[model samples]
Target: LLGVGVAQLADYTQEDLFAQALREEAAEQEQALEETEAEEEPEAVVVRRWLPGQDVRHAEFGPGWVQGSGVGRVTVRFETPWSEPGRVRTFAVDDPALEPARPLPLRRGEGMDGEGE
Candidate 1:
């Protein structure tokens, strides 16, 4: 009877050790996966200060004018012929696609009125 009890005890110890080993392996794997995902994540986009009346361009939306700006967002009016006139779109200030548009140079005969002599 005592021998049988010892055998059962030994079996339980082995099972406990195996379970602990599996738990440790699973924890290690989870940590490695988290590290890999962190490496794969894209860098944060740098937000630029945008003010009202500023001209900006977007990669997909084309040219737009800044109508207003708030804490973390900027409101823009894009010239989309297919959409309603004066339609405004709001985007995150840190959007990587939005950039300041270069001003066009005016010719000698052309003024702010765009009238050529």
Candidate 2:
């Protein structure tokens, strides 16, 4: 494995890479924002197919389940069987990145959400 900025895998050092690029990235962002113009909000999207406990995947955030959905947005709590409670994220119901996914079964050895053992 690798440590944070402790080991270098490539010709450049990790610290050196980030330290060098930080200013460049900030400059680029500043310029881009200056050139950008405000845009109109898109229409609300309706995702009636979603229901509580339904498994889903986000194009960028990976697998999760629908916690709630309505008013043009779908809220997902991205947690897996092996993970602690995951973070929640809201997305446009029609957002291209959100999609339905198959639910993973609860394997043995893992409790069904009980209190202190």
Candidate 3:
């Protein structure tokens, strides 16, 4: 079935493309309106500091390092070398449930070269 008019799609398509180009043009525009009530925004989105294999301890989940981080959150896998792999958990960047800890030792002969083999 025929929907909108032919010119409508073309006009709106042009308008939509113009809007997209406008947004891309304003990609770095952060100045507040001098006559408006707008407020200044943060310079950057966020800075995730957690790294994989880094030592970390959770209040209830014990200890684990960061598996990955994004969207103002971090994922962690908790487990000790002697035990099975730990469960994965995600928490806020400032969640009191987690804290940094010392790194763990590698498995037998893992750090050394092929000498162990």
- Candidate 1 clashing pairs, residues 3+ apart or interchain: none
Clashing pairs in 3: 78-86
Task: Give candidate 2's root-mean-square deviation (CA, Å).
Answer: 17.8
Task: Pick the TM-score winner.
Answer: 2
**lDDT score at residue 113, model 2, on the 0-100 scale:** 32
State which candidate, 2 or 3, has the greater TM-score: 2
Q: How high a TM-score does candidate 2 get?
A: 0.50
Worst 10 residues of 1 by lDDT: 108-117
- Candidate 1: global Cα-lDDT? 0.76
Which structure is stronger by TM-score: 1 or 3? 3
Query: What are the per-residue Cα lDDT tens digits for candidate 3 across 1-115?
Result: 5775686578889999999988876763533343233345445555447776677888898867789887888899988665688899999887876888766545744553432
Per-candidate Cα RMSD to the true structure, in Å, reads 13.5, 17.8, 10.0
How many residue pairs clash in each candidate at the backbone level?
Answer: 0, 0, 1
lDDT of 1 at 5: 50
> How close is every model to the real structure, measured as TM-score?
0.44, 0.50, 0.48
lDDT of 3: 0.72
